[model samples]
Target: MQYINPQLDIEQLGRAFQRDGRLLIRDFFEPAVVEALSRAVDEIDWALTYRDVNGDRVLSGEQLRSLSAEQRAMLVDGINLVASQEFQFSFCTDSLVAAAKRGESHLLARFMRWMADEEFLASIRRITGVTDINRVYAQATMYTRGNFLVVHDDHVDAENRRLAYVINLTRNWRADWGGLLHFTGPQGDVLESYFPHFNSLSLFRVPQQHFVSYVPPFAQGERTAITGWLIAA
Candidate 1:
């Protein structure tokens, strides 16, 4: 199946990427392919992903519901405290990376398999001009009201991350709704921000200072995306 829209001008996209460190291509995916991908996202179980004073945390729905009132309150307090002063976030995530690693035959796993294939990676290479990207790691994300991600440079040296990407699946996301991907300057000023365009593909170099802006209570719907990195190992 052709997941990518054949109408894309890849050469133009490459020029944009070279001129800037990042680029967002709208209507990047084929409509039929996007429908299937969206359906898969709707069906997958998502674990609550967040950060607290204890660091990264992933709580399944069942596990969260099982916590005693006081335990749950404590967890909330811990996350809030960390959010007040340091890096923190809360969202839903399911890893395609894990599925593929385990040899799963599910649709998401097959999608990951296709992504790691040369046919897909070659297109990414053509755009980014980073030929060593031999593999990919992807995860589904759902950012709802009050969920957020604080700024962080994707600089972990051991991860072999070359470029980061987000395949935005949320339809009709407004800029004012605030689930935007924001890039900041060294002085912490907003350099550029991108709305989550439906069926769009966003690509940015690694080690970039960026974050998903907070989704406020007034936002209408959840922001969904397939996010990951091109690996060079």
Candidate 2:
């Protein structure tokens, strides 16, 4: 499915980014493309993992199986712990094109390739006003009950990341169910919050304080999204 938005207003998008260092584009992907991407996300296998207080993956898959039931329960209920299901993929500058050349046919891989395409990168550059992007690091994240990420600035000098993007795939999310993307000011107060609206795209300048609020225990559905960073060459 083609995901490009030919009618995107580059000037307006740039102005929004310039104003707040962030922009939320509603109905960013076409309905058909969003449907296809959502189905593809549902079909993938995700690893159950635990993230530490620093938001780093601490335990995953078989490692969790090693823990006793009581220990596992304690870890899940502990403060500063984040439990989630996710799959991450990284593409070098030319890996996407190389994968296509080798006849790679996975739906999610193809979607990533589309995102890594020069045309798509150019479009993102126009929107964010970051022109050095040459690599795309993408992940499929699933946040269920009790999952959360603490506030942090995504700053890794080696990655040279310019923009952070999250393409929300879940629908019918409620404010009470949580999983909102909250951005905080310098004083640690919430400056803005965004829902995981279906087919919407959220982009922000890197090294900004932000986080995904915890998914409430009563949330009946999973909060899923394709999230990634656009990095310089």
Candidate 3:
């Protein structure tokens, strides 16, 4: 499953990403896979209201601090529990690792095969130059909609987390339609942006400040993507 595709010309992509801390490979996903993912997301319940730190709906309040004491308790509990939202999808960061750690191999085994498949993983390795990934240290991504992740560096505590990878599942996305990911340089300077268009797979270094802009309400539809950390062993 870890075999390399000789025709991919990975060294060039690897060098570019190393120099700039980011790389975008256009048309990385096959049309059929993209369509299947798009349909999967469409089946989820979409939400305009989101629960905040307080148990109340953030969309219904003027500020997060405005919630009552009872609401605040609900918010605290929810913080530890992640639920699917119409606009975002996030899973427990350690789900895959925990399964592997307990000697349960099915989830991770399926994932390893998925990553190595030409329809999936080969292109990623060609661009990322990652080798001998540690199965116990990785996790699955929560693929959801309009999830605008704010600017921040990747987890500072994950020792092996050197890069972030995103496989675009968005179709017909446009620059003006928004949901653009902004990458900042080491000095807090704006580096570049990539729109969530079809077949766009992006990889970037971990320490960079990056944020995703909100998907405009007027856009034809919400955007989606599969994201995971590429860690060192």
- For lDDT, candidate 2 versus 3, the one ahead is 2
When sorted by lDDT, best at the front, the candidate numbers are 1, 2, 3
By TM-score, the best candidate is 1
lDDT of each: 0.88, 0.75, 0.55
Q: In model 2, what lDDT does residue 161 have?
A: 84
lDDT of 2 by residue, 147-179 (tens): 777677788867798889989999888888878
Q: At residue 107, what lDDT does model 3 achieve?
A: 38
TM-score of model 3 relative to the true fold?
0.61
Worst 10 residues of 3 by lDDT: 85-94
RMSD in angstroms, all models?
1.6, 5.4, 8.2
Residue 45 in model 3: shift from native, Å? Answer: 4.7
Score every model by TM-score.
Answer: 0.94, 0.83, 0.61
lDDT of 1: 0.88
lDDT of 3 by residue, 1-233 (tens): 22222344567878897677788877655566555545654443322233343443423224434678897567545632543332222221223444444666453434444553454444555566655333223343322333445567776674767667776666666777667878876787767988766656778877778877655547776565556676556
What digit string (tens of lDDT, one per residue) describes model 1 on residues 97-171? 999999999888898899999888999999988889998989999998777888998878689899999998898
